[model samples]
Target chain A: MRLSTKFSDTIHLLAFLQVYSDIKLTSAVIAASIQTSPVVVRRLVGALKNAGFIDNDPKNHNPRIAIDPKDITLLDIYLITEGHTPLFVIDKETNPLCRVGGNIQPVLTNIYGEAEQAALTVLNSKTMQDIIDSLIVHNKVKQAKEKSDLAQDA
Target chain B: MRLSTKFSDTIHLLAFLQVYSDIKLTSAVIAASIQTSPVVVRRLVGALKNAGFIDNDPKNHNPRIAIDPKDITLLDIYLITEGHTPLFVIDKETNPLCRVGGNIQPVLTNIYGEAEQAALTVLNSKTMQDIIDSLIVHNKVKQAKEKSDLAQDA
Candidate 1:
């Protein structure tokens, strides 16, 4: 199975929100940043809003999304936007005749829960704000390099 | 997006191999345990062999698959078989008119690598053998309880 881009889009959107906290980031703006469609961004934002990862004013002509980057963990955002099913999925029909298959589902479910918890343990250690902070620093360095290059050309 | 049954099937296949190492496990037995067609089991077994996760005889006659469960990590097996793409998926087309859209793919790729690595770090901790051991213990307890229930009925 392939990893979905929705996960990365959510991450980028959260980071952008953190950097632009003073101003509301529209779905169009986020879509531009991620090079995706506004509709896609809106769908993700909807999920984020429902999950309490972000807030928006639908009463406004064009809704503006405000995300509390500090309050949100990557895990929370992941669960909200891109994480739908259990971490590990078992799609095949288990063998009913075998003792193992008859009971392995519950056992595997328990193990998958532990494994997912372990994965989340690492993800919880990171905050969306931290990712945003790093991105801001990266953008600053990039701008500085471009300025230095222009100066050299002049 | 979803976990495939390949991981569990691989584990069960390995355990069966360990138990009947001297004998070749025909697709029939594996299919019986997997509750699928022998053709399906053979196909999966073929994929495992191609990935070097298992070894099969060159002759099609009663091909025996040898798996070193201890040497194989679930992450390794997954990467070989099901881990070909990014961890998350994005289904929408990126906007070509936007600069971010033009660059989003590469940027996401870099970030995806890091995020996937973090995920892999957790998956790396457990091997298929470890899961099999747990299954064995669980199965034994269940069997013992069933036998007791049968005796109590008498």
Candidate 2:
């Protein structure tokens, strides 16, 4: 029903780093925010490091975003997390006698690839700066609403 | 690692019906081409029927496209098969103490939705007729290559 949350989690990790730039965080701390275990955080952190997006030290859990938040797109995160996997998977084994079965793979491959590319293109347009800004804006609005609600209660 | 293959299989099923309109096929036969079981075939067939893309009867294994192939887009088929499932999933549970964790969902909901819409837009541009055409063309090329190879052997 759902795809992996790694892409979103990766974004969350990076966004947290940007928002709390002054704070040093261990996998345990990041994992709490992601609602996952420290192990998962380390794995994702390792992946981001390999992709040259972040720098980490063994002695310190603190991570620095090597690339600007505005510079990183969801597509970049996706490429690191999902790794060019097909959006649609075809059934490989087919009755060879069926002419359509024998030749449908390549056709679907092209079509599905285009659709996946379209999704990636949309992701490419979004930067981590957009995410961090939206988070800040939404929280401000939420806080304002809560203050208003509390005044009405009083 | 991969999302559901239902979308691709749905396309495959419809393509088979279009290519072999003259042949009446039971689930067993369709399953053979799909390399899946008859039960899986029936389930998919039911989905297609419910989506108003196909008409089938218990007495007759013959199913008709019910709509023009060109008129049916991949988005239509996707809506039927996959039903607007989020392409990216966000982790819901987050540490309340972490400001980023407390408010990341809405931001992601917006971002993920846009990316999914992008994919659907591309799929909407494509039709079953396009798939059928590609299948026909690829088969011709493949057959031609086989013949040329045989001639060289002779």
Candidate 3:
């Protein structure tokens, strides 16, 4: 009954990857950064890997997944994780007797397909780097405030 | 953890309502068409009603919710059934002791907010009528096939 939280999780992971693009981050680091378990990160990474949205260095013997932040889009992650399912879901068992129910699937599928495409269209507009840039700006603002606090103390 | 199939269900329901806009439908009828339990229809109707997406006849006292297809949008139905959760999901718990985890919440929240906004932008682009139009077209195609089949039989 819940909308999958993976879509949100993927965004969080992407933000971290974008912020730490230069560093080889371990799953533990991502897990820590996101306040989640490393096992969870591994699961998400598997999906992202299958979708070719991320690269994992098992050879480095590290659990870190290297992300090409520039190459990653929110849609890239969403499709790998949450996007495969039709944007709208219908029950496998619909009333067979109702003409509408009998015919609704194909009809609904077409409609949902369009709506989902619309959803993806919006998702495609934002990139991992855009999120990272906002974070950097936030950090700068925080640093500026901290400097002001120190000056007041002096 | 999965996106509830309810939005799809609601849309299907509404599309049928759009087609049968003049009819007073019962939950049993809707459940029959949707091939789900009547209770499920009632539940969805209760939500749709609360969201002001539809009106059930107070006079009929039947187990039906009257829907106003013109006033409803796919986005309205989606948010109603899905609640105001983010389009993406994050873990409920991350290691609180990790500095990254500690900071990740606000950062991720901000990003998730933006990502959700992006998703909403797409979802908001279309209305219920638009979906119905697509459905009607699909039905016409289906009817044409049925007619062609009848002709072949003759």
The candidate 2 chain B region of ten consecutive residues with least summed lDDT is: B56-65
- Per-residue lDDT of candidate 1, residues B1-154 (tens digit): 5556677676566555555455557888777877878898888778777877677556544444355567777687667656765455543555444333333445545444556676677677777677667777877888899899999999
Q: Please give the lDDT score at residue B98 for candidate 2.
A: 70
Question: What's model 2's lDDT at B67?
Answer: 93
Candidate 2: lDDT of B100? Answer: 86
Tell me the spans in candidate 1 whose CA falls farther than 4 Å from its real position: A1-3, A18-26, A56-67, A147-154, B20-24, B56-67, B89-115, B151-154
lDDT of 1 at B28: 89
Best candidate (score: lDDT): 2
- lDDT of candidate 2 over A29-132, digit per residue (tens): 78888889999999998999988999864455578788988899988998899875666777777766677888888888888788788888989999999999
Which of the two, 1 or 3, has more lDDT?
3
* Positional deviation of residue B48's Cα in model 2 after best superposition, in angstroms: 1.5
lDDT of 2 at B94: 75
Q: Taking chain A by itself, what TM-score does each prediction score?
A: 0.75, 0.92, 0.74
| Candidate 1 pairs with clashing backbones | A3-B86, A3-B87, A3-B88, A3-B89, A4-B88, A4-B89, A4-B90, A5-B89, A5-B90, A89-B3
Candidate numbers, best lDDT first, in rank order: 2, 3, 1
Q: What does the interface RMSD come to for each candidate?
A: 3.6, 1.7, 3.4
* Fnat (0 to 1) per candidate: 0.42, 0.77, 0.48
Report the lDDT tens digits of candidate 3 across residue range A1-154: 4566676667667666655645667777787766668888878877776766666545554333355566667777777777566545666677544555656677656555665666576567767776566566666666788799999999
The DockQ assigned to candidate 1 is: 0.42
